[model samples]
Target: MKPVLLSVLALSGLLSTSCRQTTSQAPSQAEINAIGLKRGSITMCGPAQGQKLGTASFGTSCPAAAQPDFNLALSLLHSFEYDEAEKVFARVIAREPGCAMAYWGVAMCSYHPLWTPPSPAELTKGAKAIALAQRLAGKTNREAAYIRALAAFYQDWNRTEHKVRALRFEQAMAAVHAQYPQDSEATLFYALALDAAADPADKTFVKQKKAGFLLQALYPGQPHHPGILHYLIHTYDYPELARLALPAARQYASVAPSSAHALHMPSHIFTRLGLWDECIASNRAATESARCYAASAGLPGHWDEELHGLDYLTYAYLQQGQNQLARAQWQYLDTIRRVSPVNFKVAYAYAAIPARYVLENRLWQQAAHLPRHPGPLDWQQYPWQAGIIHFTRALGQAHLGQPDSARREVAALRGLHSELVRQKDAYKATQVRIQLLAAEAWTLLAEGKAAAAEQRMRQATDLEDHTEKHPVTPGEVLPARELLADMLLQRHRPQEALAAYEANLIKHPNRLNGLRGAATAAAQSGETAKAARYRKQLRKLAPVAPNPEAAAAHLSSYRRP
Candidate 1:
């Protein structure tokens, strides 16, 4: 929910999002059934893979036989199918051994534009691949320029930092784009690089706006090109810019129907704009596509991308007040035994999906009883993720009148915050600090210290407002501002609560609780017009009165009589 949301924070680990080792055996049946794949729509692109990777009309000076494979590799790269693209590029090399551009494709796969930093092993591999491309330099000037641009990143990767290398690559790509004004690939990659290199702290979004402008120029000419559509959605993923990419978000999946990532990418825009129905549809297809992808790759169970899709899907379902659908997804989540490519993204989805279920549904007992370490996962590996468990439990216990238990959870959160600070991971540490403040505030409230709780919750909201959420999460497990509003409502401060809810809605629009809280607070404060507006939004969201209990007890549990 940032102004420049594409800047990677947490969930950058999904499909274009993550990487780890592959599984050998076939996936289980439960995994297949949970994410129902459509068997009918198989002719996605061509006989090559039945995936519509979209057209990558690279004017490579290679043998005609190799050109088709080369184009396919480029298309796969655009969709962030790095390993698959590398294999196709290798096939091009086998067919035409001296094809230098194949090596360029291989190197290009190594440099993920908006995902996690390449590992040391990946850096070594990418360095060697680019060196080979340089050695077998092509005669085509455009091909040579492409290889040269990527070489800038691999040059000092051992000593220089990732951000520095990214800036260098962007600058180099800018030169290539300027030189080859007619090349759509050059325009697209450069725009992606601009997004990758854009500073997270820069609120003006200079680089993002520039990238969006460049991509929008090429969209009309290359509407079906998967990369153009994919990058366009990413470039404009911010709330302010999301509507501009709706057309692209609508079509990206069908263009590259076989790529789970392609199916999932559209939801980024949907989530930003609060189009709950569209978001639900997008992530459902995304989860199914990911399951189908893992099956095709011979993974043991599902890919981490499936977890990503599930988390987004659950969040969307919850927003529409569709708890039944969210709970069904929860049952499916409990069935996941192994994720083929686990990383931060996988960890986030696994942790967040369960937390969202309890907190959103207001199952305080479930939250209070949640295990500190959800087994099969190395809890110590991600302190920031661990904070989610502690944060949720603390809120639950506070609402349940168990101040002592909530304080213990708060202590654990503080410990994680300290550890993250010691590790000098400022981003994660800040998140933990926010959780600590929120948990402590609720604990204070439970102990009948209303003023202290109010002040601490306000601190939590202020700190959270300064930081942007990483792409891995749809939103906070529990927004600090929403909790503050809840506390205000419970204390009989309806006017103040209404103001807090209004501010929260501006930041996180169409959130079920935010809308509910606003409607409750407004009606109580005699603001009939404002109350009607919020109630109208909620009615549009859930016409059937999805959660009668949730609606009635929106503030009852925490209300101070």
Candidate 2:
């Protein structure tokens, strides 16, 4: 049995659970060869000098010949390099014809646990891969048990829901971990399975807490294990728990620097903690890594991973007031869009970069003057992308004293909202609706209906408060509640505006507009000390030039009054 096989079997519940006892005696060299582990026959795969992810044990049943290949493939799998792992696993199967684990690797690659549930076609593929693994005769009882566990994941193709299957798989993994207490890979995977089934709405993070405990316990012994660190980041991805994960986040990139996802994972914690400089550095490296990997691998379009990194990079740049850098990123994105294929990731960056740049820079006139369809990118495929553009345009128009234009944009946003509702995408529909309400408030403000504007903006903020930003995008162009606070400040309700900005900051920490608004509101409300503190923090975040005069001018540029 290969470690990749065991891990995948543990992940999918494909192996039988009939055997529970651990085998005390190790298999002989001849026996291992018979089972497909031919000593000295398999060579290590991939780049040889890259980071190692600790020792992998494929158990006594694995052929000594295939162990190196198996370990290399397992390491790639741990880093979520699915394509690379699949290729390595294919090499393993080619070298050891009876290796059941290689088939499991192929199957495992088809199921991306965190991103989305497996489609029916993927389930079908997984079923076939497991079936191939089941036919191999030399797998030990432990290996068979692992296969049975994976079988449970795809067992009833039509009956069980995805989440239910994930829960079942988690239970099966728990059994595997119990049977193999000494197996670090088994324990690491069991923790990941817990995360796979964790409820997104559960603020308590019950499953993640359990997973965190396991990973932390394993980390001391397997300090360089990619899965341990990667899973630790996932376990503490939320704002409340992110602090506990700082050590792991700081180390993961160095542990597997060759892996683009590894390079990018740290920023999740950095973004959560408002560590803008670190976030920028991590994403920059990740974007470059992605670019190099794509070029070397002969990929046609801009790698989605690269786009993902750019989104984070752009967000960090804007937050730090690096407007020129932020603008240059989108300008690069525009060039990439002209040459590369457009997917949802590309479409998202295409829409979000300009939106963030304009809104974060408070370029209301530029936003108002944006073309109906700004670029060559296809917006029809992703109406939410178009919705973002229109929302920002509406905000700009209303602020520029063009109420009629803003109202037209508002009407278009409502139509998009209705369309998303009809499409049964409640999440995106809600996002569009929030934009509609915010636009309506802005229009009211332009019309001098301060009370009506306040009510509408409050309603928009309330709606936005209930939902979180989608993971696909870095963050919103401008949080609706932040805009509400700005409106309140303009209406001379500084105390109320301060409260609103503070509330928004709790969720969206270190945002430029939120911090500035809170500072302004604090000063206006006579809390000079609090205002000074905020200004000091802002200067730290958005540092000025070395020249005193230039620094003063730059600082003044960001001030509202």
Candidate 3:
């Protein structure tokens, strides 16, 4: 699962940091051939309504196919368009009376964010729906089998215990994948389950390897397949592999402009390659197409799901130093938040806007506050959101000279994994665990335990490396490297710090933090001229003076040594 919070850097920002380029053995033709690539858009056999039902329409009958409104409703529920999806399903229940999918769709859609879950009532309705869908499964066909599998998935999703729900969802998804291996939707959904698992530290490694094997066996050229490139780019730094994937990512985005998954990615690659013009152009095109999608949906009287596009565009703007455009976009996001206020989706808008400003202006204190919430908001309840907030809190507190408070906040966040499992938030719980490992390692580094910290940090990075193959952002990995580099420098391991910083620079050369870290490492290692050169680059990049020693002192203000 790409940490959604990482949208801050995916689009266009350039890191003016260190330079360490290491070449690896080029990918062999056989290795490249193993990446089963899909051509054109994700092909679905259902109906035109099936696509909408699959992607959007869930609640009501929006004229999907002929007989089975329930089937169409099932498709909509799978795509997460719960409101309209639910209405369609309710109609099916009214007519068929015992149609199991209708009840299942109700359950699935009920738990969906579009409808919002405030109390346990929604959970009950979802359970009832799941029971109905299961009962209806007694009499079925190929379509019914597929639908039944989905019903099981949703039922498991709503279970109060996250671990159980995740396992059930995984089982259902696995069944679907086994039965219909060619079903990209099934495969993608299965991947999503892996992405959401509670203890994915190991599972991510296992799943990505599995996904790679499966992708090779089933489809070979669909580089644009949602998660394949994400996995490869993040896990290893094989430039040849990334080069081979370039065409696939580009073609995928071109073919499926409206797909949120497809649009931001090619642009992401472009950003990484320092192709500013290409990144900006792709973002512009994506933003335009997303606008059209929102207009057509006509939900909430505006674009309902284009936050993804807006996020991409925001990153693009920040990277190009088009802060003015980024500010305008932030304002627009604020207006949308005020007018719509749908779910926690707006937190991206709120968090990103200020984060960009803080980063750009070097306002560490302000940035720190943006990520700390007094309590979980509706969206903040997500494991990913909770992780992001906690990380942000750590970052803010660290910058504000409160390492002790930062340590405690991070510890409290680590405790959320247990609660997450209890709350049936398996997907989020797993992600949080990954972050917690990284955060704890950083805390140990701050506490001057270099050897122990490095061990934990490497473990965290290794797990991230194993899973980098699935479709998720590599932001966490970059930060982990940076923290390690800083730790190495503090421990007088300048060579190791330099090596790590250089490696990260290859992946994210424009990151100001990486640049700053390189400069600081150089200075501490007695390489004055090298340090001076990096400092010049850093100043050009961020133009701020952050005295680490002074910052450390400030950290003392918030908590104990």
Candidate 4:
């Protein structure tokens, strides 16, 4: 998987790639009974039923059926019946030397759970299969393009040949679409390749123009493929997809009833929409789907949601202010890491969950416990990984009033950004730039350097109000502005603080922090009546038990600054 293909976007997220495709032919009736295709359809292509066949909608034609045993092997292999899958795969390859599906079967066997460690025999088998697929692809059908793509994906897990592999997969998708324009699966995978290729240079400056290829395939009249539906809902920003997201999420839940990935859209959409109850319902359904993941992993007793399902369940709880539960989940993940810290697949989850906790809950001590260092640039797993922990630690330290330490962190981040730019790491550089601005402003604020803080804050604002131009999202603007406003108020610039606070409230009208800051500034400037009104609003927004002594303590603390 490429950096774009990390687990965050794995099933139903804004950055996930399209589903992996297959070219293994359907088995005969006898073989179907032998491998249990008759039992039920194997879920190879996302939450959908059955392997999506070729793109021909007009007629069902078996161009030339590959060996039934190979099909049986592939079917079983896909379904996680490893022993049976291997036996059948071997039987097929032994008879048909150049059959692409046979080779596909061997490559797929590595994906099985029972095949514990990557054995030398299995590695040799996979290598041979990839070689055979590459060698014979010219003579094979274009549908076999997906077979080669999978083979290539398996061969280069570290993505040494990422560009070539992705290019080949994209071409294969194009071929499939050309042959079967009506085929939903072909269209879905084509959209995925388009979405996956999004990080590359666009060659055009148009809103949604670059992704039109994917968008067209997903609209009604085409098959409502679960993978396409998930991509549309999960991978795109909330504002970009908000209007259509709710309905699409419902359709997804219906189509992918048993899929945990199905619940991500609804949970996330509801959270953005501020509908807490609906978000909770969707997350509960997602937790149930964790059972499916355990079964797939051959760990029936395991109930770890992070391993098999999206972390939206945890995210939903955090969004609703359930910090205790979120911490419990983090502790559980920590235990898992203690057992096997080398599980690279869950690396993003390990970093992201704790980072969110630190940022949202202001937990500096806990964040310090989490990993904040990056690997060598060449060993980078995710683009966000290129600087996420560093940027987060800088902000967290700034919030905790450690300006000197925060300045060092921010400077280090700036160095990373400069290096990324010098080396043309565009996406990573863009991400780091946003954090650099934030870290710079935050450090100045922490150090009580109001003038310097205002300067850096202005520079940050010049970049973009929303995440479109910078890495920071629009939702964060109000909060950042409020923090800046408080800093000004503390520096005895009440008038300027009033303007900043007003701007923040305008950006995010209902946020409690903006109201609190506005009220405090009004009170500080001796506008008793206006301060009282703002205080009333704040109480309505976020009521806390009355504690006069504590309030007086806070008032005295602010007067000290």
Candidate 5:
């Protein structure tokens, strides 16, 4: 019965193609129910309800008894609950002592392909797990093949470069995928490996596009597959491709409602498109979900996932001008810090929340008076997080007519840039340098050196234009180019300021400051037509109160529309 069921599943997978549109008809309820059944009894040979298909199956050569616990473990792995997945996979190993794939699950959790490279400790642990799997008896050829693919990822720690190792693992997965053309899990894992091996400097996103195509094909039959939707959101998490992923982003939370990351994933698209309402709702749900998970697990503090959601929530609230709500979130962040352990996520929020509150509200005096080392988190370890605080302080001090203090921050930023360069972190080095240039420009402007300030600010803006923000933080506290536009407006260069604001809108899209600056610069330049259009957009963004007629009359004077 198991063999027959396996054959039927393979045949069904073979009928699917990689080009099928997401809107194509989905599998029927009966067909889905039959996916993991043998002799009318549900088995754990494949994914069950809410479980993504993993590269493990029960068959003649692999005679380990099917247990629901194994499927639950795979589901947790798909949702990236690494700690939980590791424990559950251990249970599967204890029950089925010869299950080679159980060790594979443990190794995969440590890799964290999308987030960051494995730490040395994680690599050692994964290598040990793979060695154990290799010694297990009765492992099927396919199961051995799966283990071999992951072995390539954890093979050489001190010798091979990280990207070179990733490419090696990708090549192994490609071969596994070819060997089992009808295995949906093989295709899915191959797609992820392709994405993991993609060159970050290649803006064309060739590997990402290929992965997206495979996930799209898998979606028509397995519409609610958590891995497919989650990977799809990640593949298109850029300005140009975000809209194309709206369908997956919109459906993922519903498909895996129990997973906090699943709930949080949709907001990537929402943030990219500036869909503030949707972004707010998604992060709100995600925060609550993360809190509940932490509480149920009896953890001592709020999980990093909760802080991550709050970062997105705060950004959306500020964009919508809900300062009261944003301030409330800022207060909650301090509470979390008091109770939570200091980690990268906590440190990032510790810096970003205050930076956003002061800069977005334009409270220059408060920003200027901020502490040099504000929090207890190790600034030396996470210099990029520290850079946020210094950047804000520099901007505020310069704006408050304190050139000396601002210049001090400029020097500090240069030191930070030099430190990152020594650490061989090119991305953060570039980011800190951009901040240094902006700080210098603002300080020069405070000294009434308009021409020199413009030159420095333009250099900062041009460098910033070529780079994209890292995925770890929601965005920078404030964009440097936007500051350049503000400085241009102050210098009575309305035309250049308008162009700067327009370019910012292309990258940021519907940011409140960008919209407001573009409108004011247009009005000052006597571009009444453009001013009216921008004013109309502003009105749509935030409606005025207590004399709608007066507001309409003021805007009407700009154009005869």
Candidate 6:
């Protein structure tokens, strides 16, 4: 279940980031899939109703009367404000009934290139809009080219797979860019298509690098262009590329201060670099903006962006050693009465935020008993979200001298893993597999099969290291390497455990578990200097977590028969 919190990075990936809520009877299977189970997101008809979406200026062949609204719609489109953009495009169409580009804008709003493939209904809607534009015929060659470029995705909608169609769209956009080298909009959109169509498994990041270079060139010309900043951030949101994205990250919040999504976006880079302070601030603003807008708009409840922001804020505080602040986030979540735009993204946030709180704070019993969903949230649609609940329970049970109970959780994860695979959701399938491996590893350890447990943990880390975290999360529920280090220490191999902690810290710098585990392992291994350094770093960050759950976890770990 690629639920909320992730954005354009849902599949082709506008990275996801949260949800809020009321509950009802479960939707049928068909209804759930029609929502966002397979697709990345559902349309938010007026998500940004009262907010100020940032700027764009598209010189179009549109009538003068329609130009300003067209620019506003186009600007919103750049920011991934599909719902509002579509509405504005409709207004533009009303003003100039024959404006082919206005129809094209409607089609463009449905094309979430960075997100997962559209649902069947979404596909048909976009296809019909583009078909209308085609029939109307653009007044200028450039307008015609723009309409034709979007046509690539809709042409074979029924028969062609999403990625194949995405590539065709990218190719068509490339032609539009090559033909009109001076067209900045074409250049920018093409760059996005490159990142959107780029293979996630391609660690070389060849496409990302190229896309970044293109965005950089366009940045100076339109300094506050939301798309330019937003796409640049997305293009370089990689471990190796994060430092390069610092400028864009720092600029994004100010560029579109009124946009909850824009306010939240900078944290994506901050999270990658372990810049907890910036991350916390970003999410704070994002959550507040989202909540205010949702209330003013009189929506059912908080927007998904609000929940996504809270999830990140909680993570940042915990990483910064502000355990109490992290605790407060869940307190806020408890008060959510309902979530508007109920879909996968919101469902993901519902499952993940609470799980993160317990697991990160090491509240094993709490982790074990986490409710499947908030009363208002739907879980029947998202089996992968269910997988998270089971995985955390497995960890809690494994440490609490309940190996059989832990195994039961592991069994549930296996079933969920298979379900994700059957649905062809590769990202969530891999995530479930990672959880299954780690859960089974702990179960094996609890059963006194230490070597097998270590082997499984190692496999988990290997697989986890290969893929990027989904945009919805700040980081893993727990880094697999941290788990491996914990296992090493449990077996009394401090030197090996110290090595594992050191390696993980290199990739995920300054993580609370990484620092604490390293400090403990280094001291046990007689590396006093290394131990002191870690402790000093922790002290500089903040005090240790105030909760007693970590101590309780230790007691439970030792309770193994």
Candidate that scores best on lDDT? 1
Each prediction's RMSD over C-alphas, in Å, is: 8.5, 7.1, 14.9, 9.8, 11.0, 8.7
Give the whole-model CA lDDT for all candidates, comma-separated: 0.79, 0.75, 0.50, 0.51, 0.72, 0.77
Model 3 stretches astray by more than 4 angstroms = 1-140, 154-160, 172-199, 212-248, 258-304, 316-332, 339-341, 356-361, 368-474, 487-493, 505-512, 515-561
- Better model by TM-score: candidate 1 vs candidate 4: 1
After superposing candidate 4 on the true structure, give the runs of residues whose Cα lies further than 4 Å from its correct spot. 1-131, 137-179, 200-224, 265-276, 299-311, 338-345, 362-393, 411-425, 458-561
* Candidate 2 accuracy as lDDT: 0.75
Provide TM-scores for the models: 0.87, 0.82, 0.58, 0.61, 0.83, 0.88
Model 3, range 1-561, lDDT digits (tens) per residue?
222221223211211011111222232334322322111222222223434221222222222342466555544444443554567665654455444445545655654421223236556556555544444423334334434544443443433343444444555556667777666656655654544442434533565455545544433655434344433322222222345445545664544343443455576566565455566677666566556555554435334345545655666565454556766776676555321324444444344444454444345576466643322236535455555656666655654557687787688677777778776555456556666776676566566665776797777666554443222231342356665676666566777887888777776656655666677677767889988987787656545344454344332332333
Candidate 4 vs candidate 5: the TM-score winner is 5
List runs of model 5 lying over 4 Å from the truth.
1-67, 338-342, 372-376, 544-561
Residue-by-residue lDDT tens digits, candidate 5, 61-154? 3233535656666666676767766776666655554566776778887787876567777777777676556555565667767777787667
Lowest lDDT 10-residue stretch of candidate 4: 53-62
**Clashes in model 4: which pairs?**
9-16, 13-234, 13-235, 14-234, 14-235
RMSD of 1: 8.5
- Taking the tens digit of each residue's C-alpha lDDT, what string does model 2 give over 1-561? 111223554544343342233443333335433333212222222235954444444653557888887787788788887767767776776667567777666667666676556767668767766656666667776676566667667767666667767776677778888988887877877898898878655668889899999999998888788888999998888767889999999999878777888899899888878899999999998898888776766667567788888889999988887877888898887767432334556777777888887777767777886653344466775777778888989988887778899999998888888888776656678888888899899888888787898899999998887665665666777889888888888777899989999998887788876887789899999999999999998899888422343334323333422
Question: What TM-score does candidate 3 reach?
Answer: 0.58
The numbered model that scores best in TM-score is 6
* Candidate 6 ranges with C-alpha deviation above 4 Å: 1-53, 551-561
Model 3 weakest lDDT span, ten residues long: 11-20
lDDT of 1 by residue, 7-32 (tens): 22221222111122133222244432
**Cα lDDT for residue 126, candidate 2:** 72
The candidate with the higher TM-score, 5 or 6, is 6
What TM-score, to 2 decimals, does candidate 6 have? 0.88
Scored against the true structure, residue 182 in model 2 reaches a CA lDDT of: 81
